[model samples]
Target chain A: MILVTLLIGVLVLVLVIMAMGPLESLGWWSDKGAEKAAATIERLREEHARSDLRTSYSRYVVYLSGIGAIDGESRPPEEEPFVAAIRDGVPSACLVTDVFPYSVSNHGLTAQRPMSWLWRRIEQARFKNPEAMLAMLVNLRNAIQLFVSADRRYGPTYNIGTAQQVLESLLRHGYRLGSGVPVTLVGWSGGAQISLGAAWYLGLTKIPLELISIGGMMSDDYGLDRLQHVYHLRGTKDPFEKLGWVMFAGRWPIAVGSPWSRAVKENRITIYDIGPMQHNVKDHYFDPTAIAPDGRSYLQVTSDAVVALLNGTEVQVIPT
Target chain B: MGDFLGSLWRAILGVWGLDSSMAEWFRDYPHSLEISITIAMLAGVSTLLGNSVVLFLNRIRGWRFALSLVFNGVSMVALFVVQAVVIALIGFLFTGDRLTFFQAARAVMLATAPLLFGFLELAPYLGPGIARVLQVWSLLALWTVVTVVYAVGYWEALLITGIGWAVMQGLSWALARPLSALGNTIWRALSGSPTLLTAQDLLSGHQFMPVEFDFDVSAVEGGERS
Candidate 1:
């Protein structure tokens, strides 16, 4: 009886958390003005102008990290090699890795939150004890925001906010808008949904937008039509990506009219099997030590796949 | 205040057919104020949360909109009373139970307990699905009340509630024009808005415009910080 009561309490709390993102986006809690967004962009442009990399990069790659992330700058040490490989592969491409995908305001979990201390401790604990229950709170919280991005009612508002932040990051990294320079969004896990969510708003700037989902769990509803193409990199052993297929009705076979289905039919979404990598932990996609049967590490193989996509090279494709 | 809250809690549980004793209290006492308050709360919460029916209330902006919500809630009680009369008539025809108007009204009002969580209708993606679930739950509650309180046959209760709902829907469709006009008038009177914004307009997030940025970067490359 106590267990049942606890389960009910947890369910109610989850619902409340899920409702909060949309309510915030809808300007129920507090309205975040457009002026702040404009100011941010302006500041980024000025900063970019002073940088040495200005006008040097040919293509722009914005990397949106998964739910485990607390802020824009901080990343798990295990994931760093995957990022390093991308930078090595595409030396000319400006890789912007500081856009936090979870918050509609682009504020980190520890940024001005009432539960900042808890989140900060959770972030620290994630490194020391990755298996701790408290560490999973970050994932749980962000996973809800991922649903918010998929939600039609809230997606536009949340996506616009994220897109603005992405735009600021792009500007900060010397991405000249309307230069017709292709902007590729590389998202890992839940960040894939955020990438897709922001695609519509980013597309508005007329920069050629592309998405590369690295074992991403995403719904089909978030304006797939706006992206030039979607390159999904999945591991043969990963079951988490399949969760997206089951959770969202729009991804189902019967939802033939959905953007994702249409994108598949139109041959816009390209799927690649990046060896036998798991979703996260124990031989995950970015695990350097997890060597594939083909004599390549999971990180190396995944990086090669992403590089191939960026370079528009032929790869082993999975037919829909 | 404690007594009121306790009764309200019992009323909520009773509507879900959980507490028979509470259902008996509602059937016996049939407090109009309590029923009205329940309906008012349902309407107020739904409006405040920006449910599709009263999504325009979101556009009002500021705490003064609380007055508009109160107006919407009180008006819903009047509407519920009218609906209860129709339900009572249908019940009499189907079950041959000559229940008093107040008894029938109280039963119908109490059955709306499921809708007290109408704020859940604002939840993204699941909102519409949740609304449908709540509607079905309320219908089942109505059937339960007729069976337990009115002592009507289960089949008769189903027929009465189902046909009563169908008739009400048909009436609503037939009187759509006048009903819409009346709704608009009431909305305007309360909100001071000429027209209520549709759910599409409200939920589309068009009110929050995307910030525009200068796309021209050639000046920056040429050492000019424009």
Candidate 2:
């Protein structure tokens, strides 16, 4: 009798833990952040040649929060293939210091506002205090401006100015420098929102911007107009992608409908419901047959994506 | 007598890790009820210990560290007691026989004692809201313990306790930091009434800076003369 009770109790305890445990968005420290850093670094070493200008022909991948990685600290294993595809063909630089640094790598200092404006949304969501959220946003923006003004290399390098400033800056550089450069912007999770902001800004210039979003949370019309191709990937099993939790829990209208579902319905975007896989992309990250076991295979996937984007071909949507 | 023999056969299979299903065991060994019952008790005790250790580690540190040290020292002996009691209860209920209820009750108390201890340990760090939540949780837990004790005697129960300790710890770990952040933000917002920042603030990193209040005045003369 005692034994039976004990077994039942233990099983019940297990069930409770399983149900309530934090949704495995991504591994915070090791598997997500370190793994991603290693992958990016490896691609840089193998693909790009060290140029006199310290400039390499690499695309830029910007990860959005709540997509593949929540913070800069982690990238979903499923995202490894996308990054690897880019690394194989050209040297791609990852902008790790922008918004969403807390959950990214534990290495860099948190970027202030403007560089990390999306943090305001989280602050607003958690506290529902508009004033406080605004304060944080303004403070963050100022910090970014101060940081940006001090660093001249960043100004011309990434065109970090307003639309007119970007035009002037481009004219100064004769529009000849980045003419053939294929800069593919990859935004994961919440970064999908940030990518839209970037797209809106970049639309002012003639710089060819290729925007690819994996698990994007926001659907901005501005981004849609500017984007030539957008690859939105998600998994059906992913709780983060499901709108039900937010709808019931936050009691927000945004939760009532899925963003991807909407994007698909509007025909403004292409959605790829990948896999029988969960939100974590571990299954694809270490696939020896696809990417080399030692993580060499990660670049192959990135290269494939980059080549596909550059060719202006139809986006391939993979099931999450 | 037939019931006892059936339990014994089931217990032996459980101990040997041979027959996971009690129904299957009854089919195979219809005679060794006493032995089967003993096996069940032994297995229940071991499971309690194993689960308790996992729970203990979670409470102290977190899953990341627990994953590293599977055989750490902080073992929860109460887990085994709780497990034994639960198993016995299942057997008694299924067979329509009386169980060692007091023993099971005692076992459950021992298992859950650490959780109470954990609540006390983190009391200082808890804010008002968290404290309120924990207080209610602890009170309910205590009620459960007392009820269990009243229902059963200590010896026969084999007191398997300390279930859900890991779950509690995990919940605490996940909530603490984010909750703190949310609290601080709300507090600041409620207290400070500042203006929104313009694009200039974006450059400086603030929508609005707090107004400075200085009580110092140069030299106040008689009446209006300074």
Candidate 3:
């Protein structure tokens, strides 16, 4: 009995650890952050043709993926592929932060709001399409591990912790340009939530934060008012997060707070409802993925938007 | 086969109070306040009656037994209120605006199932290892309750447990001191030595019992906050 008990105890502990994922999502399971940073630095070393590589670029545009990973690698997934894409994307002049954190990496920060949003949608879809209902169930079960992610459950847990870790990593690598390193956030799917949470937190520290959310799930302001500007890009067939909007009337100001309508009106939050764009896309379809993904990979557009913001030029939010 | 074992293991753990079922049950359960009061009364009455029965079994007689009986009765009456107040304060501190007094009291009452091990006082040496292990297990159970109800982190749960215990201990010490002095005086009158006032004797004499519910602070699995 004692042996069996111990075995089960150990087994449960292991299962829990696996579910928690990567150092219990404390952001330092392995030295992945440092490893990624080194890889980015190494890539820059070869590409920039700089021998000493003593002083790298000052500014950075960090891409945080939505959900899942790219090429089955630890790196985050990129945007949809394209047709006859424009090559006028981000120039290699500015520094681009290349460490990508996957969505499953944040299984620990899965907040209830997102899951509840999905649940409400599932309930509404019950009367609609049976196929959509099945899809929703599959998505729910697949993402159930992340259902009650606990970032807000604590003062500054999980996603916020990841954001801080990312910065700490950048700072650790002598990447600090000045008192505050100018960084733009390119967040995809759930990654957008992390970016928004992080931007607000980093903003408090006087770090200049610009946000670009691609098919993000969270609809709340996430203190976006304090952010530089939030660019939200939603594709047409992105059926997942739209459920939150439709089910709860998208923005229930009474419960959480009022709609960020004024913020949207003032161009603080810009929504680009990009149709014919699914959640998944080819990588090299366009020059810029943000406004000008004529439509290529978001990597280029994200970089271009950041570069534009860095150069003090307004990147077009719509086709000119 | 492995899958079945895993599921069975989880079910067992659920019964042991590691899962959120208990917490969720309390969260969505109506009549929480009623349940909380009922549990509190149950714990209070059980402790008092259990101790009195122990004293009787030990052959405590006359004035000493009478004194112990009266003290136990009064303690029975006061335990629930004291526990509720202390647990409520700890819950407030741990959960911020998340938990209310009634919820905290309920969590505390549910959490007391582990302390029923105190009934082991009847037979002191019936698996001492089992006693210690149960206490630790109960602490985890308490953690689950706090997390589900309060939506708190494990560390926050630890703080709640620690603070709740410290406050309770402080209260017990305060309440016991006067009774201790009185017991010592009565023992002297009975020509008894201070050291000879055993736990059983004190109860039989209606004196104070400096019983403590404490464990090594370092034993809380992960690192505990100082």
Q: Best lDDT goes to which candidate?
A: 1
Model 3 clashing-pair count: 17
Top-DockQ candidate index? 1
lDDT of 2 by residue, A1-320 (tens): 89998997785454333222211111221134323333433433332243233334343444333322323443334444554555444434533223442222222222442334465354444245423444444333322322221122121111122222222323333333234444455655445544554454354333466566554444332444555557765545556455422422222445334433344455656555543323433433223344333344433433454456555554343423
Clashing pairs in 1: none
DockQ list for all candidates: 0.25, 0.01, 0.03
What stretches of model 2 exceed 4 Å from their correct place? A1-84, A90-107, A110-182, A244-268, A281-307, A312-320, B1-226
- Ranking of predictions according to lDDT: 1, 3, 2
Show the lowest summed lDDT stretch of 10 residues, model 1 chain B.
Answer: B202-211
Highest TM-score scorer: 1
Q: What is the two-chain DockQ of model 2?
A: 0.01
RMSD (Å) of each candidate, 1 decimal: 6.3, 21.1, 19.4
Per-residue lDDT for B69-159 in model 2, tens only? Answer: 3321112223334344554555355334554744443323322222222322211111122334433443343334323433433322222
TM-score list, all predictions: 0.84, 0.30, 0.39
What lDDT does candidate 3 reach at residue A301?
48
Number of backbone collisions per candidate? 0, 92, 17
Model 1 / residue B81 / CA error / Å: 2.4
lDDT of 1 by residue, B10-122 (tens): 67766665455666566666464476366646634653463532333134445535654554554455556766887788877866778787677777777777776666766
Global lDDT of each model? 0.71, 0.36, 0.47
- In candidate 2 the C-alpha lDDT for residue A203 amounts to 48
